[model samples]
Target: MSPVRMYTTQVCPYCLRAKALLKQRGVAAIEEIRVDQDPKQRDAMIALTGRRTVPQIFIGETHVGGCDDLVALDQRGGLAPLLAG
Candidate 1:
């Protein structure tokens, strides 16, 4: 599976959902950057993804976006193939 990275907050339900979906899709490890804990990281996340939201996700350098985006990708049968790379 491709490495998963997520910009997340501690109490964000979307972050939790995104993580759960990645886990269910056979992602064993996730590099979680806690943007909420570090104010600088939130700025970094915005700079990197152009989004100021928790649960900004990446799968192997490909930006998978947020929780709803992830779910839509999975439903479209794109998630597994992306992770496989």
Candidate 2:
């Protein structure tokens, strides 16, 4: 499986939901960057994704966008192949 990373806040429901979906998809670990606590990480996340939003997700080198984007990818039958990469 490719590496999974998520930029999240402590109390983000979308972040939690995103994690649940990832878990269901057999993701054993997620490198969570808590941007709520660290301003630097938040800046990095924005710079990398071009969006300042909680739950910015990266499946390996692919920027998977936010929670809804992930669900859409799964619905389109693309997430599994991306994860497998």
Candidate 3:
């Protein structure tokens, strides 16, 4: 599986959902960056993604955007292939 990373906050349900999906897809480890606790990281996230939201996810070096985007990719049968890489 590709390396999974996520920028998340403490109380985001979407973040939890996104993580659960990744786990279900057999992602054994996730490099979770807690942006809520660190302003510098949050700023970096915003700069990289151009979005000020929790649950900014990435698989390998590909930015996967947010929870809804993740779900949509799975629905379109793209998630597994991305994970496989």
**Backbone clashes under 3 angstroms, per model:** 0, 0, 0
Q: Which stretches of candidate 3 lie over 4 Å from their true place?
A: none
Worst 10 residues of 1 by lDDT: 1-10
Could you give candidate 2's per-residue lDDT for residues 1-85 as a string of tens digits?
A: 9999999999999999999999999999999999999999999998998999899999999999999999999999999999999
lDDT for each residue of candidate 3 in 1-85, tens digit (9 for 90 to 100): 7999999998999999999999999999999999979999999999999999989999999999999999999999999999999
Q: Could you tell me every candidate's TM-score relative to the true structure?
A: 0.97, 0.98, 0.98
**Order by TM-score, highest first:** 2, 3, 1
Compared with the true structure, model 1 gives a TM-score of: 0.97
User: By the TM-score metric, which is better: model 1 or model 3?
Assistant: 3
Model 3 alpha-carbon miss at residue 35, Å: 0.8
RMSD of each: 0.6, 0.5, 0.5
Q: Model 1 shows how many backbone clashes?
A: 0
Q: Give the alpha carbon lDDT tens digit for every residue of 1-85 in model 1.
A: 7889999999999999999998999999999999878999999999999999889999999998999999999999999999999
